[model samples]
Target: MKTYHIRFYENRWIYYCISLAVVLVGLICNVIFGTRLDIQFTGGAVLSYSYSGEIETQKVERAVESSLGRDASVSVNKNVRSAESGQVSNNVTISLAGTNSITPADQTAVLKALNKAYPNEKFESLKMDSVNPSMGQSFFLKCIVAVLIAFLLLNLYIAARFRKIGGMAAGFFAIFALLHDVAMVYFTFIIFRMPLDDNFIAVVLTILGYSLNDTIVIYDRIRENRRLMGPKTPYRVLVNTSINQTFTRSINTAICTFLAIATVFVVGSVYQLNSVV
Candidate 1:
């Protein structure tokens, strides 16, 4: 295998500049396009309607907006359920995520608009759900607390495991790496206009574990190298050598994870599972 030596420490400032650029761009995009919180985080109304025939999603969106005078999302799932009598049906979920509940009059008007738009679709209202904004805010706070607690627990564990050579410092850096990973994910949702939902939480938790594992592996290698290289070794040399030794493993791990996530995303797209995508 061909190996190329790279001086990461010497170019650390470049990496910092790149990270700062990304953060600034993300913040710019966030300001241009505000954060979209899902019903779980923002109080909203969800109206699910079963349709007998083909209904274009764009038409549904237009109908809702025209009737309600507000923005809404329309997700259409195909062949979602099958009746025992061999009739197949599709579902259209209309979501109005805002601070207030959708009024009955507004819902009726929305239904009328939908019916007027697609008279042959036979849209039947399945269910209407309203989420309380205060409750959603509370739930969102709880999720944040849960993530923070997880980070704290993981830091404690790392500190305990690596107590011999400045365990707290190691743990702090590991948490810093985790924070970077999380910030990327957060900025991605903002940039792409994806709603912060359960999927966001799931992705964050998954990333925490994934990143922590990689951090631990590198830290373990560093610990081993420290013992092998003697106490008199320069700190820069120790860190550089340890990182170089584990670079291949880190690359392979990242590639494998990317491929796995790509596969799942493709599958979700095929199934029209927008949330999963």
Candidate 2:
């Protein structure tokens, strides 16, 4: 196939401006509207209740709001299965997010109030995730540290392995691209008002692995060209040539992987969120 190539750095200023705009918009959204956090990061209680009969989710929300005197998030987790049918049964799970009181009695009171409202429904306190505000801040800081450490270690490994090529500078550019992907995902969630829960972290890590794999493939081609074509070939041409040669493979791999993830994500969203999660 004839290859199409686009220079990434020839108009470096354009990418820089686009990157800046993305980051700024993401920051503004995060600061103003903020991400919808799940029960994990901000310590809260998740109440999973299954009603024998179908119930309107809004009704449950209203009940929880009136009783607790605060709005609580309510969602359905339809994963419960019927023993007889060997299939998923009709079940509605309610998740209430709030900062639990420090004392055991206070926590019990919250649970008791929920039980009092719906005596017939099955109730399960799957887990309690509560961290003090100070602790939560520390945890956020640690997450950032972990990502930085991973980047540094991976960069070092790549630099050492490809020292015959451009060495650390090439590795650094690849790492920079990985960072771009991470930042893009972060900003996407912020602008879309999507929740940045534990899943977001998993997505970021997955992207890092993906982006690095592609970078290595391209770098290997670049190294091969440098050896066979000689140093007289400008690095820019070599880079562009390498990108064109391997672009199909990279794109095919990425497309297949994305399709698989999309299938799983769709299924999870439609039917198996609780069990899958």
Candidate 3:
């Protein structure tokens, strides 16, 4: 495609600026309201149990809350059980704020509460998992250090490779693109109210890798154009030209990779693969 064909408007920088502004807003929200932590990040007990009988979701929640003597979260695992005709099946996942030892008395209380709600229902306790904030903090600190190191290396590499276009600006702009994708992923998770966990970190890393690859390809072509087509070309024109030249290759690559990841995501979600999500 020609440069004009690919061009959306006279100013491409506007798109970049808009993306930066959006990310800045998300960062501000993250700073103010804070991240929605998962059970692992906060002191909590995750109870996975199965229930069989006619029961409503609200009744299950009420039972868990009454048993805990505090507000606890309850989620249904529809993937675990098949709702055959006339049969009500569900796997209840209860998350309590405190990560104390689950005593036999606690289990009995919960069972009794659930029994009160649905006389014919039965509660089968399966497993429990717990984590503390200190552990989460330690993991978060490591991730921060790793991201910083990666960004530093990216800066040095881009600066060395693209001496023109003010290496500092190009490198920073590449980082800006990376921050854009990361912020978008976080915003998506927040909008969905999904638990913020290690999967989010993985998504951020994937975005960084993708953005870095795109920036390097565009910068490489720009450098080549400057050498062959002459540096007299305007900066905007040069960027647009390089982008048009590499558009097909870059798009094909991203599409193929995205298809593979999308497949994994779909299958993972369908099969309830927590590791992939």
Candidate 4:
């Protein structure tokens, strides 16, 4: 067997520069486009209706805006059950901002407009929900607090566990990496116009946990290698060797996890499952 040595830490500055560039770009994009917060976070009313005919999303949006005297976001999804069964349904969801509670009159007005536009098609209201602005604000605060607590506990754990091998520095570096990942996610959301909602929070938390676990595994390998190589081993060699040893395992794990998630995302999208997608 032939062994090849890779100098990862030797060019560490390149990686740092690349990460910095990505983060800076993301920051600039967020500043220019602003964040897109969903009804769950921004406090708004969502009205969902199921119809059996083809409906233009623009027409529905225009109808809603004309009725409410304000612009609203509208989305339409088509679901086909089976070709043989010939079962098809279109779901229309309209999101309106600025009000916590939706009044019956508002709902009636929207329905009237929709009927006027699509006289032949029957629209059945599936659900109408609203969130108070104050309640949404409270939820946002709670999510922030939870994330902070998790980070603090993770730092403490890493510092305590790797104390013999510069655990505090390792912990701080891990946190920095996690933050970078979070920033990237935020940037992606802004770039793609994804809603900042409960799903966004879930994704951030999941990434933090996943990245921390990977870091801990690498850190454990480094500690073990240091013990084997003795204190005379150079820090760079020790770190690089540890990473090289675990690189294959890490790649395989990531690929498998990503494939699993991708499968779910694809299936959800195909089925028009908004919550899953």
Query: Of the candidates shown, which would achieve the greatest TM-score relative to the real structure?
Result: 1
Count of backbone collisions within predicted model 4: 0
- Looking at model 1, residue 48 earns an lDDT score of 89
Model 2 segments more than 4 A misplaced:
11-14, 52-71, 82-89, 102-149, 266-273
- Per TM-score, what order, best first? 1, 4, 3, 2
Worst 10 residues of 1 by lDDT: 1-10
Segments of candidate 1 deviating more than 4 angstroms: 1-4, 52-56, 82-86, 119-122, 132-139, 266-277
lDDT of each: 0.83, 0.72, 0.75, 0.83
User: Tens digits of per-residue lDDT for model 3 on 13-52?
Assistant: 7987976776677677767666777765767777777777
Candidate 1 local lDDT, residue 238: 74
Backbone Cα, N, C clashes tallied per candidate: 0, 0, 0, 0
**TM-score per candidate, in order?**
0.84, 0.72, 0.76, 0.81
TM-score of 2: 0.72
lDDT of candidate model 3 versus the reference = 0.75
For each candidate in turn, give its C-alpha RMSD to the true structure in angstroms.
3.0, 5.0, 4.8, 4.2
lDDT string, candidate 1, 1-277, tens digits: 3233667777789989987877887899889888888876777889988887788888899999999888888888887755655666888999898876677898789889989999998888878998777876786688789878977987898899988767888788888999998998898888788888878888888888888888888788778888999988888887777778778877888899899999989999888776667
